[model samples]
Target: MPKLKLDIASKVLRLANPLRVAGYTFETWEVIVVTLDDGARRGRGEASGIYFLGDDAANMRAAIEDVRAAVEGGLDREALRSLLPPGGARNAIDCALWELEAARSGKPVWQLAGVPQPRPVVTTFTLSADTPIEMARGAVGYVDARAIKIKLTGDLALDLQRVHAIRAARPDVWLGVDGNQGFVRDQLDALIPALVEQRVSLLEQPLARGEEAALEGLASPIPIAGDESIVSLADVTAAPSQFQIVNIKLDKCGGLTEGLLMAAEARRLGLGVMVGTMIGTSLATAPGFVLAQLCDFVDLDGATFIVEDRLPSVAYRDGTVFAGPDVWGSGRP
Candidate 1:
């Protein structure tokens, strides 16, 4: 491979406003976009602000800095993949490579990535914590959506009651829950039964990441999904004892390169995969939507929170997301 040139820049995606989910509130999502120039063409990559994982825009910038010398010194995407572990660092470079290669070869990212044509995917619209009446109203507004993912933390009964009200209001809506590692042992026991009764289809990260062992030998009524609990292959082994589903995020797993591998591993373990993302614009969501091809559930609504997303955003129709017009890697058109 010829020597490649790399340039990195950081920016913030300020939400139209604050989005409160359980214990965290964010008015803006800091992101880093890395552009790889293989002399003739350029490819772009992005990263989201992952507070829980201790990744911010600054760290993402630094990560890119550490690899710039090597990346510009003729490091191809494959080399970058092996040189860096799956995480923010690899995510930027890998996506950049995909874009760079696509631009150089004159192909779309989907073609190069070998992913199937993008499909219409139904994603979850999060119901932020609020008064039962307020939440019910929000659910009622989105009643037309195929499904919803309610964010919850403390007060299991109250949360369930709120969700119950929403369910009652939208009798046809399929519901899911994400506790974000806020549930304790007793809370899980109580919430699971109610969740089952309410026909909740998924429960994400009911316990803290490392505390997944708490689920050992304990059968859950609802399909327990792992989000923060699983970041790599080691995180997948806990399937038999901890969770039946895995949530794959490019930011968390690095990029589509590792994400595909993680999804494959989860499938081999008979664990369902859910493709998720940090709230951002269509640029961020597009990559995740491609990964959603292998997932049973899709949570790529990150762009919805933005007040004004970048133009040429992913085509979202009736909860189903379509691929963007831009070729992911062939080169910025």
Candidate 2:
């Protein structure tokens, strides 16, 4: 790898609507974008900082700066893992390395990642927590979506109402619900039945982080996914004990490299894998799109909620999403 010019910046992405969930309501998101240029080749990456862990855009930039000399001095991706903790800063730089390799090798990222031929994959469109009627209407708004993920607070009755309304409105689509770590043991036990009634196939992060033990011996008909509970490859061991599925986001796991490793680990443990995202643009979503090929479930609709997205964006067509090579993977330089 040649000594590369590194450029870092942040973008404030406004949501099309207020994204209301269990513990947070997001109207705007700040993402860090990284670009690596080596005279003839360019690579780009984006990351939605780990806000829960206080890894905001400012810190993400600072993290990059902390290791600026080593990076421009030709620090490789594997060494990068040690340079920065698994978070937005590492995710951005790691992905940029992947893309840079793609450009240098004249291969698309999928091929670089060992996927021969990648295809568009169906993804779940999400509806934020809202009144039952409003959420139902939101479901109808995703005209081409074949799958839907509904955000739910711990309010058992209201959550049930929202699911029932959406199910009634679109009985044809696959359904799932995210508690965002809003429920306790008893509350989740109470909510599972209602979700099953609505044909909800997955329950995501019902219990708060570190509460995976409470789920022991509790079997759910719907596969429970560990999102907030599992952060990166280090947290994969905790999944088999508490969840049937592990949700991998590049921002959370740090990058596509760890995301792929986490998926492989989940498979080895006989746990399912899902590719999810924070609210971001196509640049951020594209790397996750590559990782989705190995996943059982996909939820890469983060850009769909944003008011303005970059051109050459990921396309949501006929209920599936695809990002052409032009998006960010290769041919940029």
Candidate 3:
């Protein structure tokens, strides 16, 4: 086995504006980047830990450092699954391994994974949780976007008002809402109907993870997606009973290898898949974009919130994400 060199670093990206999600607000995106060198080739990966989920840059870096010996001794992606629990650290290392293999074999990561060619993906632009007027103003900027995802914080009246305002602003764009596990089960009855009236196409994680059983046999006006509820293959198996769609984030699942398997399994179980991401640079969104190819909804808009992105960035024109050949794992020669 060839000895591999590992490098880990952290960066804080200033957000273009304060981003308010269901539980917290952040003005900066803290990311952990990993690079591996085999003396002949180099591979790179990035991870933006889910802050609300108790993941942060420092801890992710420490996790990577914990596996220094294993990585240097030639850790492969499959071995990595057992070595590290699913989260930012595993995501970074798993993606790095894929990049390393692609560089070594002179093949794209998609080819190595037996995935079809990737094309420009149409993605959703998000409106951070805010007042109805403010969210409407945000929606105005994304008029050209095919779909817009609105963040809600469980305020039944305010959340409905925000959705209605955004719909009034951009009636032509499809609308989706992510409650981020902020809503209570009782609110869904009133909220879902109001959202449906405004033509909201999707509702994501309206209730908390453990509270998902409340959705069983409940008829919802809008299709619901499971974000917090489904993090692993086993979660995917249980998701169909609670949700019509499963939101798969690479950071949540660990990496592209597992994400791909999860998406495949979700489809086999007749659940729609949505590829999402934690706020980071194009490096983080690129791997999610690959997974987006197999998804019914694409939410890789994390880069849109950052004021600056890493070089060889993924490009967004209107709502389409274009991955260039210069980027890692782009699967382009």
Candidate number with the higher TM-score (1 or 3)? 3
Q: What's the CA error at residue 277 for candidate 3, in Å?
A: 0.6
The local distance difference test score of each candidate is: 0.79, 0.91, 0.88
lDDT of 3 by residue, 1-333 (tens): 588999998999999999998778999878999998899887788998766578788889999999999998998999999999888999999998888888888888878877668888889999999899999999998756988999999988998899999999999998999998999988888998888899999999989878989999989868899988888777898887899998999888899989999999998999999999999998898888878878899998899899998888998887798766577774332
Ordering by lDDT: 2, 3, 1
Please, what are the lDDT tens digits per residue for candidate 2 over residues 37-120? 888888888999877788899999999998888888878888988878889999999999999988888888888887556789
Candidate 1, 245: how far from true, in Å?
0.6
For model 1, the superposed segments whose C-alpha errors exceed 4 Å read 330-333
Question: Which window of 10 residues has the lowest lDDT sum in candidate 3?
Answer: 324-333
Query: Between which residue pairs do clashes occur in model 1?
Result: 87-254, 98-329, 99-329, 102-329, 102-330, 103-330, 103-331
TM-score of each model, paired residue for residue = 0.94, 0.98, 0.97
Q: What is the clash count for each candidate, in the order shown?
A: 7, 0, 0
TM-score between candidate 1 and the true structure:
0.94
- Among residues 3 or more apart in sequence or in different chains, the pairs in candidate 2 whose N, CA or C atoms overlap within 3 Å are none
What RMSD, rounded to one decimal, does every model reach? 1.8, 1.0, 1.3
> Best candidate per lDDT, number?
2
lDDT of 1 by residue, 34-107 (tens): 88776678877887846788888888788778877898887876677777766776787788777777777777
